[model samples]
Target: MSNEQVISSVKDSYLVEKRRNQMIKGAIVLFKEKGFHRTTTREIAKESGFSIGTLYEYIRTKEDVLFLVCDAIYDQVRNRLESATDWDNPSVAKLEEIVASYFRLMDDMQEEIIIMYQEVKSLKQESREYVIKKERDMVAMLERMFTACLPETIDEQDVSLLANNIFVQGQMWGFRRWMLQKQFTLEEYIERQIHFLKQSLSTDHMQNEKTDQTP
Candidate 1:
């Protein structure tokens, strides 16, 4: 590559990785405090240690920062889930691993997850579309993870809904942490959620078998 080409590539890659993270780091603080709708680019710039002008070099608006935060949270969750889970494992096993990984992340990055939950609705039109696609992608990943655990009777829509439900419950866990922590440690809480989940969706058919046999 020419020297100018190499310089541009380095600049682009550095900006791609750095400024976005700077935005996410700044956003975590602002969104937690002022909230998504109330926060401003200048404030985000202050928190992120960049001027509003520099911030705009990477992103055009506060809404962009909002999406960056959402994307960052998902990226972290995806990494945790992928590393801690064995996708080729049986459906039930994969589900358990996914929950474990998810709970680990929620406990580890509680603040960031909390920020995403609180701020996602503030994303603007194109920005909202970007995040919605990422959200769907996350759901799809879990749906595939749900595949092995599902019985023949369950449809994909059911599995997808169940995956979305689990995601929702996990998100709520951060919000209801006072109540959850009151009852159990994070590990114990995860175990409880998994147990309850399996009981609700997983064992119904088996119980039906016993009921059918008894007659």
Candidate 2:
């Protein structure tokens, strides 16, 4: 389904965008503070500065708001990753840069990220599926970038796993901050992850080279 269907009752494109943004902004604050289960539609409306009736005009249910927040978070992340890197013929160094940028964005949106992981189960099946698909798209994007970086030397499976791991590592900072923050600053975390990732991928490349040389 199209993203416009995320909020269906509204027909005006501009108004739908405007109201959804307002609702998302408000719902995020509530969800972050009270958690999804405890938060009420009334509170979301109040936080968003809209009446209960107005909230319904844009979203059919509170779950819609949750989905919207998750959607926005991904949109922001993908935008940052795409804009910062040279997508065409990206090098391993460029992939590392993307990973570092992703971690920083996660740090900046830590609270929202926390809510996203903790609350995603609350979304209805269809809504959950949509979010999951968007997530897959993101992982696939990274996989493509890494595959391009290494070309014939890197195993596609290795790139796929690394891409998935990179995505999780970024989210881990948000959900595991209480522990991670005690051990490393954001810059340190970013640096170490990139280093570890580079080392791992390089090892795979070297092994691939050895196998080819042996044959």
Which candidate's TM-score is highest?
2
Query: How does candidate 1 fare on TM-score?
Result: 0.80
TM-score per candidate, chains pooled: 0.80, 0.93
* Residue pairs clashing, model 1: 91-148, 91-149
In candidate 2, which residue pairs clash?
none
Relative to the true structure, candidate 2 reaches a TM of 0.93
Candidate 1 runs further than 4 Å off = 1-11, 149-157, 207-215
Note the clash tally of each candidate.
Answer: 2, 0
